[model samples]
Target chain A: AQSVAQPEDQVNVAEGNPLTVKCTYSVSGNPYLFWYVQYPNRGLQFLLKYITGDNLVKGSYGFEAEFNKSQTSFHLKKPSALVSDSALYFCAPPTNTGFQKLVFGTGTRLLVSP
Target chain B: GAGVSQTPSNKVTEKGKYVELRCDPISGHTALYWYRQSLGQGPEFLIYFQGTGAADDSGLPNDRFFAVRPEGSVSTLKIQRTERGDSAVYLCASGSGPSGANVLTFGAGSRLTVL
Candidate 1:
């Protein structure tokens, strides 16, 4: 089964500073990685995806992620974090072998200090 | 175009009571899915509907839980004899294609509370 792991339960970052949320995955075939964010009482919003392209993919709100095949990791990063960026982040892998499903991470709470 | 929408943002029902949650997928979406999310946990798949047929129902916990997308547009998830453990947010999502590569757009979930 395909799965995603986010080692950190929570990450606190100072506003205007760089921030990164790590994500790693285990899958059988070519991986389709995704990052989503959830604010209070809202649905999960798509941030970015790594289908097949340059290892670096940019997404909403100046957020970007690096897809490292060797490391099997897709880490979300931002050059300068904002207080409004604080929310729950989830990393998911889209599995296509036999079963077409997305395995989501446990979620990491991000706190940005002003 | 409008995004996926779910009805009854908050529902509180007594234990063992029947409950129904509705979802309206995006216009012309070919796939719809139902998932449940407990507090502090990620969403778990419950069922998936392709057009008017249920392509996958294996994720359903028991016979008490059933879902139908009669028109391939709107879907209803019904739960009979709901238990306290069933209390969670029920989320609905729709994507344009059946492939895992398709981006799924989700709705504001229906928060179900079994009292």
Candidate 2:
């Protein structure tokens, strides 16, 4: 079974500062990890994904994620945060094990204050 | 082309009423997905369609929830005998290729409220 966990319920950051949203996973084989953002009354927007390759993966909106096999973690990061970046962040384990259905975390609310 | 689209941005119904939510995927995208998001929670997978067939429907809460994609372009999710517990946002997403890449584009979800 593939599953994801985002420990924090909410994370607070300031505009122009660095930001990080953490995630970890549990699966039998290699994992496909993803990061998505959801603003109020909107659908989730894909941020990044790590399937295979280097540990560091860059994605849309200047976002990036680091995959650590030993730690079973894939964390989303950005060098400079924006008030516009404030939203709900979700970490998901790709649904690839026969079913191809993703299992998502509880979501972490990112509040980037200016 | 346009991104994935969903119909009836908001749907309100009584507890026993039935409701159907629709989704139109990208022109050539073959993989489509349906998920449910409750207040303060992340989206939960309900079903996934690979072409015209339902490849997975494991996340569906129960038999009351049904979906179809006969033409492989547009799809509809039907919920019968809705309950208060059914109140949530129904989100639809589409991705390109069979690999189910990380490039899943989502539609503005349909908000369903059961009274």
Candidate 3:
């Protein structure tokens, strides 16, 4: 079974500072990794994914993630955090046998202080 | 629908009662998925549909949980004898491909509360 682990339960960062949400994965035969964000009372929104490409993958809202096969990590990063960037972040691995199901991490709540 | 839509944004049911949650995936999306999100945990896979058939149901916790995706668009998840443990937000998602690499659009989710 493929799984993702987010060690941090909550991450606190000051506004305008760089932020990184750590994610590590375990799977068999090259796995797909993804990052999703959730605001209060909202669904998980797709942020970025690593399928097959460069280690640096970028997604919505000036966010980017680095996929490190050696480290078994795909940590989500942003150059500068915003107040609005505060939310719950998740790291997931492919859960679909063939139909795109996702197995997600416990999630890390990001708190950006203004 | 513009995005994956789940009905009854909030559902309140008594323990041991039965409840049904609905999901309407985006039109033209061939893959539909159901996930359960506990209070502090990330969403966990429940089942997935490739077209009108359940391609994978291995994530379903027990026999009390059942899902159907008739007509290949809308899906319904039926839970029998719901327990307090079953209380969580039920999420629905859809993707353009059957492969796990495809991006999925998720719904706001139906918050299931078992009293």
Question: Best by DockQ, which number?
Answer: 3
The CAPRI quality class of candidate 3 comes to: high
- DockQ for candidate 1, please give it: 0.61
Kindly list the per-residue Cα lDDT of model 1 for residues B46-78, writing each as its tens digit: 888889999889889999999999988999999
TM-score of chain A of 3: 0.96
- Model 3 agreement with the true structure over A1-114: per-residue lDDT tens digits: 788889999999999999999999888888899899999989999999999979999999999999999999999999999999999998888853554667777899999999
| DockQ result, candidate 3 | 0.85
Model 2, residue A95: C-alpha shift (Å): 3.4
lDDT of each: 0.90, 0.89, 0.91
* Cα RMSDs, all models: 1.2, 1.4, 1.3
For the record, the alpha-carbon RMSD of candidate 3 to the native fold, in angstroms, is 1.3
* Candidate of highest lDDT: 3
The TM-scores of all predictions, comma-separated, are: 0.97, 0.95, 0.95
lDDT tens readout by residue for model 3, B4-96: 899999999999999999999999998998999998888888998899999889889999999998899999999999999999999999999
Give the poorly placed runs of model 1, Cα more than 4 Å off.
Answer: A97-100
lDDT, residue A85, candidate 2: 93
Instruction: Encode model 2's per-residue lDDT on B18-82: one tens digit a residue.
Output: 99999999999889999999987778999999999988888899999999999999999999999
Ranking by lDDT: 3, 1, 2
CA lDDT, candidate 1, residue A21: 99
lDDT of 3 at A78: 98
